[model samples]
Target chain A: MKIILDAMGGDNAPDAVVRGALEAAKEFGVQIVLVGRGADILASMKAQGWDTLPDGVELANAEDVVDMHCDPAAVVKQHPNSSLVLGARMLAQGGGDAFISAGNTGALLTAATLLVKRIRGIRRAAFSPVLPTKDGHAILIDAGANAECTPEFLLQFGCMGSFYAQKALGIESPRVGLLNNGAEDTKGDPLHREAHQLLKRAAEQGTIHFVGNVEARDVPFGAADVIVADGFSGNVLLKTMEGTAMFMSDMMKQMFYRNPLTMLGALLCKKGINGIRKTMDYRETGGSIVIGISRPVIKAHGSSDDAAIRGAIRQAIRAVESGFCEEIRANIGQMILPREEEHAE
Target chain B: MKIILDAMGGDNAPDAVVRGALEAAKEFGVQIVLVGRGADILASMKAQGWDTLPDGVELANAEDVVDMHCDPAAVVKQHPNSSLVLGARMLAQGGGDAFISAGNTGALLTAATLLVKRIRGIRRAAFSPVLPTKDGHAILIDAGANAECTPEFLLQFGCMGSFYAQKALGIESPRVGLLNNGAEDTKGDPLHREAHQLLKRAAEQGTIHFVGNVEARDVPFGAADVIVADGFSGNVLLKTMEGTAMFMSDMMKQMFYRNPLTMLGALLCKKGINGIRKTMDYRETGGSIVIGISRPVIKAHGSSDDAAIRGAIRQAIRAVESGFCEEIRANIGQMILPREEEHAE
Candidate 1:
């Protein structure tokens, strides 16, 4: 299998992406096509002591760079040769099995939707990010992809998330939970209430295993395999988790650095703190996948390091081998609205 | 000078409530009126070694109790003499300076609105919770009170939150931020975008000190004094913080207990950990205030223990002294929409 990676994307781009692709190529036995300014990629690799490109790894030169502030809608028309758009085009043309990027999320979503395209009959593509749980991880669908959503959109999110969990994460009959303020089926506003009804109907049909409503407070407890939500709430959940983790980490550092005894305590429990970091760190978990797209495409965290990029590549390879998109296409009937047609973004 | 306490409301009432009121009355130099069934209050206090009501403490007999699952709309009518309703009624009748409970949130909201009433011209009563931030705390307004809110409601939340932060929290010209998915002005759905515009105008009009858009990740960093959001997103943000705190606490416990060395480490650094707890604990922070209400009303956490309740009572005393409601009433005109006559929830 071959993977297309945007080496020019993310904060630590070129070096991090190139190094991660090399590591993934060696470990996963997959061909990696690094898309970026070819000379810069080679030089970054050379700076890290890799004087030449190794086997199973190739370079795709794309001169233009996609700015983080660039308009998503205009990326296709304006920066056709940008690394992000070119990577999407390569995946669309089947030059590689999957495309990976850590560029501007909106730009990538647009490129993926317009160039790589969504699965047939799918109304909206969802951003499914795997969130850390107590003992495992749960997928949060539409984690800021489509801020406003219809009941139909949520239903589709539930279906797509279920499929992704089962295939990519190897969870069988994933429990789909709707993220809400309360646990009752009657909870939430009109949108969530109506979405609950649709998801309930879909569950009865055996398309997905629905576990009533899951509150945001119970999200990190691993109560459900897939937590489906509109992008707005999902994004809040994701970012809140990030903020709390950061706050606690800072507190922990301050707590340890207070005096001599605490500093010694920290040294003794370094391994244990590493365990906590391992569980909380997004760097270890890989990237969020753009669900409902025609092909596998992963959006790594924009600040991801080389090791983090390797984790994302591993996630991408697993996604490719899992045939997650095929399952979505085969189960498309379950995702569509009964008699209503809507505009697809 | 007098605080009415719901002696039969929370999970640990009337034991915890009575003890907390006793502590608050002694420490904060405030008069306490404990409202509940007289017998239960006496027995619980007696069980805790208090044979009679202490000096500065009094009791008001209320025969009924409000269950957590009780409908908020019917609480006043069905349980007229319940602790929560009686407390709100007492505040409305000027029987006390403030009322506090940790019972059914809906029930409390109903009592506070139907009996205690709202500030005139205010469209909605917001549940403004004091969230722990890097340095101090930020108030999250509409933190699950009105799950569905209009842009006008959000504008009011900003105004009310700012006033509360300035008066109750002792901040000057409190900065209000609209909670959104992105920091950019054009980031969220129509509701948030409209709310952003409204908040911006309020800022220009010198009604609120607007700090533009604040993402959930920046919420814990103390960027703004007040974070105003529609109830749904605000609730998600609040609960997500709780969930993350719980998850981290659990992980820390397991990490400390991993081995003898880590166990000793935990013992040595116990004080620092307590400092961390002091920063993150909701118990230390006390209750969320019902903003836009006629008087100072606090909704303590449902599972509040004696210390937590004591903290809430102290908060209530501060709110009463702060003249928070008077400030809201004085500034109510700026919160009202020009021509939109919406139903007040």
Candidate 2:
């Protein structure tokens, strides 16, 4: 399998991206096409003591680079030869099986939708990221793709997220849940209430394993395997969990470093603290997968380091190997047809 | 000051409520009127081995009790003599200066809105809770009151939350922020984008200290003193924080009790851990204040203990003494007038 990497993206850029690509190529035994400015990419590789591209790895030079601050909607149009645009085009043109980028999220989404395009009958694409929970991890769909969503959009998210969870996470029948303020069907705004009816119907048809409404408080308890929400609420839920974890971790550090006695305790408790930290770390979960696109597209964090990039690459390989996109394409029609047919009837 | 308490509310009601009322009456030198089933309240008081009611404390008869499962909108009419309804009526009749209940949130909001009513010119009342942050605390308005909101409602929430933060939390000029998916003005759904423009205008007119959009990730780091969101998002944010904190705290406990070595480490780090726990505790911050009401009303947590009830009483007294309702009423006109006039013009 071949994977295209946007080496010019992210804060660490050429250095971390290049190192991660080399590592991923060795580890995954898959061909990696690194796309970026020729000079910068070569300098980064040389700085790492590489005379030439390593085995299973190659470089595709792109003249332009899309800055993080540029307009996402306009990047593809303006920077036609930018690394992100070129990488996406490579995946669309069958040069690579998957595309990975740690760039501006909006730009990536824009490129994916405009170039790779959405699956047939898919109204919108969603960003699904695996978030840490108590037992394991849960997929939060539409993490920040579309701010405003209709009930139909959310129902599609539930189906897509369920498929992603089953194929990617190896869950036999991932329990799909609608994220809401309360567990009752009557809870939440009109969108959620309407979506609940559709999700229930989908569950009844056995297309998706629909769990009832899951509250934000129950999310970390692994209440559901695939937690589906509109982009706005899903984004808020994912970020709030991240922020709270960060705040608690920072507070823990401050407490340990406060005085000599606490320092001694920290030393003894280091293993356990590290254990919890590792569980909470985003890098361990890899990058967010942009679901609903025709091909697999993974979005690494903009501040991704070498390990995060490697993680993203691993996620890309998994998506490609699992044939998750094809699975979604095959199952989504059945999942959505009943509702539409019922409406027509 | 006189405060009305719904003794028949909450999971630990009657017992915790009576004890807390007695404690508040003695500590704050305020009159406390416990409203509940006459016989049940007396039995709970006697069970605590209190032969007589304390000075400045009394009881009022409320024969009915509103269970948590009932519909919030229909609670007042269905159970007219319920403790929650009676307490609200007492506040409305000027029988008490304030009302506090650790009951069903929807039922409380229904009773308060039906009885005490909204402050004139306010589109809707909001539930403002002082959530813990790194520095101190920030007020999240419409925490779970109105699940659906218009731009006008959120703008009013900003005004009311700002006033509450200033008068109650003592922030001279509370920075009000619209909670959105991104910090950029252009980010978020149409509701947020429209609210952002209005909030910006309010800041320009000096009605509020609008600091523009605040993302969920920044909420825990003291990003803004007054965070304004529609009830659905605000409820998700508030509950997610609480849930994350609970998860972390539970993990910390598990880590400490894992083995003998870790247990000793826990002992040595107990002070610091307890300090962090105290900082995250909701009891320390008291209950959520039902803002935009004519009179001060507080909704304590349903599972509140004596300490939480006491905290709620303290918040109620603070609200009553601060003349917060009058403050909101006085400035609400200016906060809302410009938007209406602008549309008209």
- What are the runs in model 1 whose C-alpha is more than 4 Å off? A340-345, B340-345
Would you list the C-alpha lDDT of every candidate in the order shown? 0.91, 0.90
TM-score of chain A for the candidates in order shown: 0.98, 0.97
Candidate 1 collision pairs: none
lDDT of 1 by residue, B1-345 (tens): 999999998999999999989988999889999999999999998899998889999999999999978878898999998888999999999999999998889899989999999989998898988899998999999899998989899999999899888898999999899999999999899899989988999999998899999999999998789999999989999999999998998988887888999988898789989988888889999999999998999999999999999999989988988988899899888888767443321
Error of 1 at B77 (Å): 1.7
Q: Taking the tens digit of each residue's C-alpha lDDT, what string does model 2 give over A1-345?
A: 999999999999989999999998998899999999999999999999998998889889999999878899899899999999999999999999999999889999999999999998888999999988899989999899999988888888999888888887899999999999899889998889988988998888888989889989989989999999989989999999999999999899888888888888888888889888988888888899999999999999888899999999999988888888898888867555455644642
TM-scores for all candidates?
Answer: 0.98, 0.98
DockQ for the candidates, in order: 0.83, 0.80
